[model samples]
Target chain A: MKQWYRDTGLQARMFLTMFLLAAVYLAFISFLATTGVGTMGIVVVAGIFIFIQYFYSDKLVLWSMGGKIVSESEEPELHTIISRLCQIADLPKPRIAVVENNVPNAFATGRSKKNAVVAVTTGLMHQLNHGELEAVIAHELSHVKNRDMLVITIASFISTIAFFLARNLMFFGMMGRGRRDSGGIMAVWIVSILVWLVSFLLIRALSRYREFSADRGSAAITGQPAQLASALMKISGTMKRVPTDDLRKVEGMNAFFIIPAVSGSSLMKLFSTHPQIEQRIAKLEEMQQKMEF
Target chain B: MGFLDAFLGKTKLPKSKTKDIFAISTANVTFEVNLNLRALNKAGICFKPQASSHFTQARAEVEELLAYSCKDTNTGYQITKDAYGYTWIVLEDPDFEDLVSNIYLVSEGLIERDFGEQLLCALFTFKEKGGANVYWIYNFKHGNFYPFAPKANKERNSAFEFRLRSVMEKELPIEKDVERWYPLWDVPV
Candidate 1:
């Protein structure tokens, strides 16, 4: 099979992030065991949380975004583009949905490739050209192909436990009257907080790297990195003029969107779910340059 | 995709799978004898064009090579772009074998130039006794064939398409998932 452009830097960074995440999680679990905090309770809670999330994520995401699943007869152009991309990517056709907002964004969500759904906002359909729209949908399909939903869900397992422990441990510490066990509870609370904070950063980093990987996948599938680059630019450009109220409604979904809804804060790069738009476009331009050769 | 690739967030596009396209030529007899469908002796290979100078130059050379080689086979061909921004290399020949081989040539030429991902599908036209148009679409990416019967106003005759699939499934590499049976509206074959 012919290979597209490669990015060792991104791959290495992703590897390093996963390694650190695993290390952090292992240490957190060990700490919980030593502190005599019932790890089973946290694990069961986290498991239930993830199970619900994994199974119903598509429905929840679409409903939250006000998306409507459109039949092929309703959105023939959209369906055709998705069909071609899916065929090229060697994926099962995913359900196509359209959101009514004019936010110029799109997302993909499902537990597995077979049950995935790719959605676009009406504002996005009106904003981009045919090539740009295809490019954006290709990016979303890449997310599905790479199992971003599953990866992110599993990666956050420890974080979810740590968060739950952190909040409840503090409350338990406050209620206890004795200093002997109080000290142990305090130690566990501090450890849980540390684990949660560290894992939070690592998860965000992992998510951003996944975005870069998905961008590369989009380029590989469509053979048009420039089109995706332009789509990102156009989406972000229009995102600026969109009403803040409109953006606020969908801000919680920034992690899954092609471009984060809120812009203009460079300091938020580390915490943001997606990489900076400029950086993403630069990577895509690099692919475009390599393809020219 | 392999487990390792998914774990590493790698999604390389599948290689062009045009080898199974020849199954259509062999199945042509089944269509004529059993289904009352006659070959129109016309096929179109559709591909997406990259916005790169390299692709444009490679395409020019490929077209020149195509024209040079088709002279002996007497296969008529023309290049056209559709409203959806896909390019089509339409081939015409009375012999079904020639039409099929020419479609392969176009796909092979592009794949050799490292643009296999750009190759979409090839449409082979067939006509019924009632003058309705039926097409056997060979998806190059997935290497599966599907039936597309278009009625007026861009409506599809699903019943006829399903009938074609039933008859041709044994002879051709028919696409099993009907969802991948994408309709190519305004196909200029």
Candidate 2:
């Protein structure tokens, strides 16, 4: 049997981070319950926020990037490769999308695999060969298989609530008065800030691990890690040649892009959705080497 | 998705699996008894070729040795590369049992030569009421058999394939993962 390489260390750290995040959320909920901000109010508001993100963020992301869903006839080759990858991944075929841009990159985002979408830019089709393109598609499909979108959404929920709490306490003042009056607000503020700070790094670290795991998933589905490595090289190599004007076109949605590109969301945020190109390529190469044994 | 499994990103559900492809040979009787499917007595092993000189030499040796061993029998083999770059070593013989043995011998030769990882899959074709091709692919990596019957360009006869699996499931170690049933379009068998 094909024995896939697993990064137990990375997996353990990810689990620990999630465990700690859960703990922090538990304490935050308890704080909310006692501090008398009407936990119901916060829950309703958070629920609405998450509900919108869960259901509609995909459309918003697609629209913002100027992507349109293509029929199978228009891109049969793409559909064929994706269908094969799905079978190998045991994933239901997700909706396929194509953005009319010159960027040689792709990403997968949706609430789940059944309703998921894998979009590749026009340039990516031109840039990669069949094997390389298959690798990218496999990577995106792996994200769907691993449910990275949902994990990131949940992680986003935790941070959004923390940010919301901290901001409300800072600007609009505390809701219900607790036993300690001003002291309760201060305590909530400290907790929110701590959660926010920790989650910023923690979430970014998780994002990086998700990228690595997705790379591994791609290897598993395609059975060719080197194809992904070469695809990364070709994309990154051409990423430099694609011109700044074109890069700025998709800059608004760079956070969700596969490469975690330039000109948006501070070049060095402690958190990013995609891993570095060098590191991703290296990971795929390592996977390729390990699969030999 | 338990709280911990979801946290650890265990959402990628593992599909069904198998390892002993010899089960395919053993399971052929069920196909004939139940589904009216007959072995075509033509089988092939599809593999991605390594770029090494040793691999090239080993492939040539396999071809030569098979030709020598089956000189008296009608066993014949040919190596053809598909458009997608995978090499198919096709074997043919009227005796169904001989085809399986010949396939096994060639596969073992490749594995003994340390080209095991390069071996992708072995396939044995089956026929329904008429002369329509139904291929059962044995994945070398997973060591399981899955049915693949491509209709047109990349379209699969999945409904019929599921029926084929039902017939063979009891006797063969069928691949549980529906995802692993990769189609070999326009296969020359």
Candidate 3:
């Protein structure tokens, strides 16, 4: 019996979410096997593409965000803090990157622990205090520890194939990507479209759950749940005044962000890549009260 | 966590490990004789506060015990709230052995009370021949000791600290990383 506790039920929730996604992928594959050989070919091609993406995701995402990996000499304070947090998290020291923007956001990107890169915006550094910054870094390191990217990438593999098939079929006028129109072409197109839509939602939901798990992980690593919760609130509050134009620019990478750029209360709540700030903060505050006393 | 780590059920092993601080008492002889440093006869234990009653009770008990135990040792202890919100149990005694024993008692009491993880670092203040300050900081989290000799704001006496570390390496488990020699700036003596 341990004296302290935080919410790791989020881990089980992520697993269940992935399990549901795996089931959906299994059904899609079973349906595809009945359709034709073209579907299997698409699967093979998607696997290769996913493998490439996984290997170079850290570089690709950093490039896309105009982020650069910094050396220890250049950002010794950042490196020192991250290494200390990693020591607590029991993880390898991941590369630290910095993005020269004012959006007040931070993210972790990589396919595995060894290949992880944690990037933060300049605004975040200017905006948060030491404890807040440390808490945010702990959150990013938690994501690396969780390997949420790898889990989602594996989940997305089959969905990407289905998406490739569906999009190409739509472009090729209901034909199977320059292949002979088998009688089951109509069925494959419908199944592909359904799989694409459903998998997209499932991945988003899993992503949200993983965010919760990472929040919990950060609290555990730092042993200061309130610090993380306050940091989230600070970031989210700062995010609102960061100019909607700037927010929209990187909104595409919302899934990888500490706090998404979305404003208050959107219609896309169900499709949100991250949980609501209020919900996350409430959970953390509850954890703080329960675990501290 | 990796799939293998999860499969092996290795989730969340204890993050912090605490080592015996009595080593410092033995190492004091080497530091004084070899490095020409003498204990200022002042030591302090730092810990982060928790809101738990158990922690509060343990802190109260430790303070009471320290007060009672030091009544005849010509030693005095002070409780200070540092600027960083970390609480310090500062002890002073002309006899270095009494200071070390007092710190050991407070630390052991906290450990027995299940609040050991909250213990941050134990500081044994020492002085050079010319009255320069050097600290042997025992990191409770990492279970290692380090020498911190801070000169003005954020500036470190790196050369001297490194030499002290090299001299004391065999006597104590010196923290290998220079970055982790977290300087206790403006620590209330």
Candidate 4:
């Protein structure tokens, strides 16, 4: 049973990242209290926004992708693949939606396992053969199984709050009345910015870690990591050839996609919601090797 | 899934509970005595047949086993591919117990061969006094039973299904989440 899914290094990094995020969040909140910043209004506003976004995230994602939920009759092959994977993964069947795009990507969204929706682009179906497509769909199902939507939403909550505080503090710092007051406001503003920056990077790192974990899940479910690796390679290879206009249209959903629409540059890599395709494929290949042995 | 497990994306494949299907065999007595529902002498195991050669080999082994076992019980079985791309192993026998055990045998056979996850659900057909079809679907993964009474025009008789649930909830492991009571439209049983 303990064949290949365990990754001690990955787990350690994920735990450390989460621990650092929590520490940053706590320090920021305490700093706000010490400065008497009156965060009740901000907390309430952010709470309401995140709540709605979390609750309706599946619908929001589907709408943004222009995905239409397809019935079994419409896409029996897709449904069959998803249902079979769901059975293997011990997950309830999630609603399957199809987007009429030539982007060759897929994503899973929902607040919880029961409410999840998995959407794949038309191009993915047209491009991948049976095993490759099943591998990709299994990867999306892993996101649903791991509850990536809920985890990412909760992790980003503090980043959002810190961002809001930083922006509002910036305006207040500019309009200060006295030197001493301005100095105090300046210190708080810097702390908020620092908190925001740290949380944002941590969140990105956490998202990348979740991606690796989901890949492992796909490996576990399908028992074929090499297929998923091949699928990822094909999608990434196809992504480069897709029109820039098409990539730009779906770029906003990079975090949820099987492969981000854009890649390159170390600076962009640091902020990327998904790990680089080469790195992901490498890990999957390693898993495949372990399973084979 | 635990909090830490979810955080780590660790999951175990759920074990198939083909054994729990025996509950339906005993519950048939209650159905006949009180609900005026009679077993249609037909039950089938619907599964998504894999395209791989190994699955074909496993299924062939299951067929060979079924053929060998049915010879002794006088139970008749047929394998038919449905329009919806699912393979149904339909079993017929005057003895309802034989029908139940045969369905169980086929599922167990596949499971033992490591193709158990491909078995979708086991469906047993029953009829009401007026010739209306009522169905009991046993989800292999979940190990729960759900009533599916299909009406004409692609509709379900939820009221009647609910009554069946309420009545048999004590004797059978009925699936509580109605959302998971997926309808098997045009089931070839």
lDDT of each: 0.86, 0.73, 0.76, 0.83
Q: Pick the candidate with the highest TM-score.
A: 1
- Residue-wise lDDT of candidate 3 within A165-238, one digit each (tens)? 88766555444445456556767888889999999998888878777777766776566778888788788784
In model 2 chain A, which range of ten residues has the least summed lDDT? A170-179
Per-residue lDDT tens digits of candidate 1, residues A1-293?
23445787788899999999999999987877777544466567778987897899999999999989999889988888888778778899899999999789999998999999999999999999999999999999999999999989989988988898888766655555445577777788888899999999999999999999999999887878989998998997843534456777888976775644556575688799999888999999989988876
- What is the TM-score (0 to 1) of candidate 3? 0.73
- For all predicted structures, in order, the TM-scores are 0.90, 0.72, 0.73, 0.78
lDDT of 4 by residue, A215-292 (tens): 888776676677788788788785454445677777897667564545589888889899999899889888866654
Model 2: residues >4 Å from true position, as ranges? A1-4, A55-73, A90-92, A169-183, A238-269, A285-293, B1-38, B47-74, B101-122, B127-131, B136-183
lDDT of 2 by residue, A110-167 (tens): 8877788899999999988988888788888877877788888887686778877776
Kindly provide the TM-score of model 2 when superposed on the true structure, using C-alpha atoms.
Answer: 0.72
Between candidates 1 and 2, the one scoring higher on lDDT is 1
Q: lDDT score, residue A94, model 1?
A: 95
**Which residue pairs in candidate 2 have backbone atoms (N, alpha carbon, C) closer than 3 angstroms, thus clashing?**
A87-B179
TM-score of only chain B in every candidate structure: 0.95, 0.84, 0.88, 0.94
RMSD to the true structure for each prediction, in A, is 6.8, 7.7, 8.1, 7.3
* RMSD of model 2 against the true structure: 7.7
- Point to the candidate with the largest DockQ: 1
Better of 1 and 2 by DockQ: 1
Q: What is the interface RMSD of each candidate, in Å?
A: 1.6, 5.9, 4.6, 4.2
Better of 3 and 4 by TM-score: 4
